[model samples]
Target: MRVKRYVVNALPEAVSMIRSELGKDAVILNTKEIRVGGFMGMFSKKKMEVIAAIESNQANTPAQPQRKASPQANEALEQILHTVQRTASAVMEPPIVTPAEKQTGRVEQEQSIIDEIRDLRQYMVKLSKQQGDHTALSEQLYELKEHLLEQEVEMQWVERLIQAIIDKQTEQKSEFTKEQIWQLAAEQLEDWLRPYGGIGISSAVRVVHFVGPTGVGKTTTIAKLAAEQTIKQGRKVGFITSDTYRIAAVDQLRTYANILNVPLEVVFSPMDLPRAFKQLEERELIYMDTAGRNFRSELHVSEVNSLLHTSEDSETVLVLSLTGKTKDMAAVADHFSKYGVRKVLFTKLDETSVYGAIFNLIMNFEMYPTYLASGQTVPDDIDRFQIETYIQHLLGSSSR
Candidate 1:
């Protein structure tokens, strides 16, 4: 090992010098802050004294004999190392442009990014009166954040909600009241729930297909929708099933179809879809039930995609159970999203208390939900998706 001492203006300069000379394999042995260029202590300049060393490669690999490199290989390696060193040095030194302006702009951009991070951190930490003038608003926001978290809402979602509230508060400088805060929060949910979020009956949408993981109650949800449109709205509805994977599932759907008194078409392959469509051409709404498959399997997803050929005529609804983990639900949504899943339907709402996953899915996928199925009863268990209903469920408050 060889050790050398370096005196430089800063530790980084010393480190760069040591690395440039002995390479990154050099180890820092010791360092000390020192004074230099001074006749008296008053005029002294601060500097760093560094001692570094590197062991010979052969010393570390003593057990193995060193293999001799061919002359051509050694020359190539040396050339490569030289190029790398040149590139690294060039990157370390900035180009000679409008240096001062460039540095100033870069610093401002960095500071802006830092300020944004601080604001986000502020969202998590309750602000004190010593911090700023918005003490009252800060307390309200802090309380709002705690309430959402107590309901098992995700931290990022809560932060986003708080950030949005802060933005609105900046614009409207009104006396903040407890009722006003609650009213503002509810109104914000309205904006989050707009644009394609409304649930209704329409003649424009022809083929509505439901797909999801196993035991999410997709068939039952379909039965509920069909019964509403046929019996209540007096619209002509039809049923189609590609769920031939089990005889029991087909029979269950057939029972619903028999009770509803609607024609049911069973298609074993993708080619049979158009034939089914032809059979029910005069129907106003055709609800297609897909076989429940493990969405994690690529083969199964592809098979569903092939059968769903999902055109403008089709509106596919991916059904998910609220009892599932958010990550798994996200994965199931992402996997099936490729097959043109325009809307979602959540089942088993009664099984879980936390409903943040519902909102998270809406924001993450930008796909709004159509219905929420809370129980086993057909036509009675499913309700249209409404933000107020979800907000009530999330807060554990009964709808008024």
Candidate 2:
């Protein structure tokens, strides 16, 4: 085999390079991300590293017709084994390093490359086993895959969901219609989400703290929840805000407090939390709003976490916005999850059509969803999260 490696900006670029140099018979042995250039590890550019190879006899052959069926499992296994052996051989070679390369963290880069190669080998094997006769799947299954992917659901979750439907088809010896496919998807999603579903803020907890990144509508969500406690439940509600970083945030919550006739206390730091709680001691339930910072940074998350110290029983809700990117929301969730913040509330639901981020965050972080705030209307727009409703939003209309 003739093996070659190309580093390019994307997979498409690498494909073009391989096609021209390695011929149509060339198969991708591995592909991974690598950082190319940087100043002391501060501003590196991301690049893709693709390794491809072709059989010696076929390297000079004319392009052949593309096959209609997926490659046989045995052929895939043989290719993966060959690649693994090649990788092992490469790893055993002696290092040929220069002084500049040593200063550039060449050793670390080499280790990263080795790790990527190992991951690629395992993934190739998984594909060989899991993706038998990929083209033979029903159109409904393909549509389901496309829909979930478009919704930004994680790839592994989508695969497992589709696999479940495929297993059902095998047992029944029949293909599912569009409606049946969507129904099965709903059932599967509900089953996965059931354990983390239907958990609202605890009534027994005297205080509820809302924390999240800036611009996620934390203060607005607090107002909504507080209105529900004060108006509907008739509980003596109080507000304590540590969001003095932004003058408008405190003013916003204070305005809501005034309208609802709930007393509002402002605390500048953790030390002031005691005084604020003492003032609201007579209240049945106190809602604390923390300053929304870039919680994606661990320092900011820890800074907010410090303000949560209290003797009263309290639960913290990691408030997220539907309009935010799923990856950024996951980062915020990951930071709060470390501090034992398991309950979540999603806001700005009406602003975005996508609902997969809610499901992704809940499933990935094992979080209990508390409420979904869909509109600007206080109390009326926010409701206790229902799995059925969320799944419906996630799947959308199935009339097609």
Candidate 3:
């Protein structure tokens, strides 16, 4: 391998210089700008410095004893030396000519640079083909180009995150059987919910508290669960909503409670939560829907925490929307994790086109999904946590 650096006034000139010196097999390693002192101390030029390397197959070939007076090899060496010297001299001097002459020179320089790049690309392709590493080299070149294009520092952080995920998936690929995939997903969910322990339904009546960020369908999800348990399992269901902050939110849950003929309690504070639970003691399943507040707001989170901590056995399912960015979803999960959230309920699966956020959440935060609500239908729209179904949905294999 031979490494060379060329500093010139423009990219085209630097590229041409590199090609002329390196015989069109050069691989660009790096490029940067530097200030060059010109004729007088008062004048300086911004030059582009390009570092390139060339790999020679001849370097690895076995040397054989040769007869003296091989004029062809000597002639080739002299030609190479002449090209290097000429390119170096050209790089050292700035072009000084008439405007028309300079324009023509620039056009020719650009065409030559393009030709050199094409030749180098072809050489790389031939090398890759000979070594049977075309795919690998192509992928490496693509990654190099991507890195070069990403000039933002934040992009480097994003790249690291993507790399970490790819590394984790690659490491676990061998252990990932269809059954193991399900088990792994379930275990991840169990881990996320382990802090809150199992869902408690000990008393004659059990109260499950659902609290999370706004627009996560906490009220509708609670209604769906209550309806499923009451209508399908024949369990007595009671509904309580603390969404008095919005009249429309209160009306929506009240309408659902009325249709099911289950008593609904509307509460507003931490003190109201206990009273509401006490009033629904006769019911077999009690679902408490709290007001959805901004998880990003410290004051709102603190308020929700005060209200939710009223019951030790209450299962606070952190409802997150599936239609959000991965980072935003993770932020939401992290923010709600502080409120003693045990399980996660991912909603609005039908609204999103991709499940990258879900994959990221499960892989990064290890959050277990207790339920996935896909549609707006009461009871029918909700389903128990099934990793296969979630995967199928994410992969666009499911009709549902």
Name the weakest run of 10 consecutive residues (lDDT summed) in model 1.
124-133
> Candidate 3, residues 19-102: lDDT per residue as tens digits?
456644456665556778877755887676778777876233332222342477446544544454344345445477789887
TM-score of each: 0.61, 0.69, 0.57
The clash numbers for all candidates, in the given order, read 0, 0, 1
Candidate 3 regions off by >4 Å? 1-91, 94-205, 397-400
lDDT of 2 by residue, 1-400 (tens): 9999999876656655776787655677876667888899979987767888888987876543332544575576556656654554455453788999888877786687588666865575356334533544666777888888888999989989999998998899987899999999999999999998867889899999999999888888888888887888889999999999997988898899999999999998788888888899999999999888988899999999999978999989999999999999999999999999999999888898887888788889999999889888877998889999989888989722
TM-score, predicted candidate 3 vs. hidden true structure? 0.57
Alpha carbon lDDT at 287, candidate 2: 93
Model 1 misplaced stretches (Cα beyond 4 Å): 1-140, 150-152, 167-178, 199-202, 310-312, 396-400
Cα lDDT of model 3 overall? 0.62
lDDT of 1 by residue, 1-400 (tens): 8788998765556655765676545666655567888786778876667787777761332221123435875475455434433333333343565778776775665455445434532331222112222333455676777777766677887877777777776789653655556566766766776764785434578887788888889888889999989989998989999999977888989999999999899999988988898899899899999999988776788888787774536667889999888878888888777665658888998898878888777877777788888888878888888877777776543212
Find the candidate with the highest lDDT and give its number.
2
What lDDT would candidate 1 get against the real structure?
0.72
